[model samples]
Target: MLALERVSKTYPNGVEALARFSAAIKQGEIVAIIGGSGCGKSTLLRAIAGLDRASSGTVTLDDEAISSPHAKIGIIFQEPRLLPWLSVADNIGFGLADLPAAERRGKVARALERVGLADKADAWPRELSGGQAQRVAIARALVPQPEVLLLDEPFSALDAFTRRDLQDHLLDLWADTRPTLILVTHDVDEAVVLADRVLVMRPRPGRLFDQIEINLARPRDRNSPLFDSFKRNVLTSLDRSLDRNVPDRDATQGPGQAMWW
Candidate 1:
């Protein structure tokens, strides 16, 4: 499991980005974090990725503490961030240098086939389209088969068609390994389409405000009534998190029920 215990972060300039936020995610679960601007969405993701340490509390995968970047954790940002000089195949195998050359080649070949980029194996980053580059990025992250993958608005920049295509493609890849996926996104539809649960956050020293369980099944139809209902719940919770005056819709189960702190 991936767990965050009383995680808090304060910048060197005396600004607090997160405050005692906590949650425990089981293996193979897909969780989406949504919030208003300045709500520390990226801040929290960085803490979990070990790119930034929390001022207090702890982040752990299974039983191991994470204070620095770990091999078991992989991160994908909004941009592909591929090496310009490297071919698509080389970029995907960049982390497999420790493996023998033949083994590395085999892994890279499989990744290329999985991402549907086998034909572009020798293509440079500049030669590929936006969606293709992002596919390469996803393949690169999955090549190592990390225990957990952290994505920060990875598909926000792509067009609607491309975004949806990649979302489906991502799920296909995810089903093979069942790694824990923690995503930070602003798109409610995307969140509803991809996550098992949606975590809403409050701004100004961001902290957990609500957790809405998406009971819908996989291969969900975007236009289905059930899918829309879950999306509406997340949207309403987001509004309440941003503005306290917004009336709560579901009073039965209070906010932060799934949170540890």
Candidate 2:
């Protein structure tokens, strides 16, 4: 389980990314964080990942304190961030630099097989399509058998068909590994379809405004009334949060630089 206690992030420039945010996530669960563009969902993920420091509060994985640096949290960012010069297999195995050659090969092969990319093991990043590259990213993150997987809009860039395919693949991967997942995405349907719980965050010094449990059975049908209600509820919560956060003048200022909650 993951526990976030009074977690907050305030930059020196006076921008408050998170303010007194707290939540608990259990093992074998998929949670989605949704919010306005600048609501600090990504910042919260970064803080938890130890990519950035929180000005206050504490984060712990199964009660172990997380300080300046975090360990065992695997992350997949918006981009693949793969090495241009390395083959897909090499990129997936990059984090396992200290492992023995044979062990690393086994791990890489298993990961590729999970992502359906074993055939592309030797292929370069340039040779893969958007969805393929994202799969490579997923494979790399999964190779280590992380206790938690943090994905920041991993499939947001792909076309609709590709996105749906990858989403299904992700669900399958999660079912197989059962790692606690925290996905930050702007897509309401994606959140409803994938997450066991969806957390809606308010902007500027973000705080949790809503905690929604997705009751629809999996594999969720996007067009089903149950799924639609869940999506509508999440979006409504997000809309209300944004309206309450943005000033009257700023409301006319166009979409805030917020990210998905």
Highest lDDT model number: 1
What TM-score does structure 2 among the candidates reach?
Answer: 0.91
What is the C-alpha local distance difference test score of each model? 0.90, 0.86
What local lDDT score does residue 175 receive in model 2, on the 0 to 100 scale? 86
Question: What would the TM-scores of all predictions be?
Answer: 0.93, 0.91
Tens-place lDDT per residue, model 1, 9-88, is 99999989999999999999999999888899999999999999999999999989999999999999999999999999
Query: What lDDT, from 0 to 1, does candidate 2 have?
Result: 0.86
Error of 2 at 84 (Å): 1.2
User: Model 2: per-residue lDDT, tens digit, 27-70?
Assistant: 98899999888888999999888889889999999888876545
- Give the C-alpha lDDT of model 1: 0.90
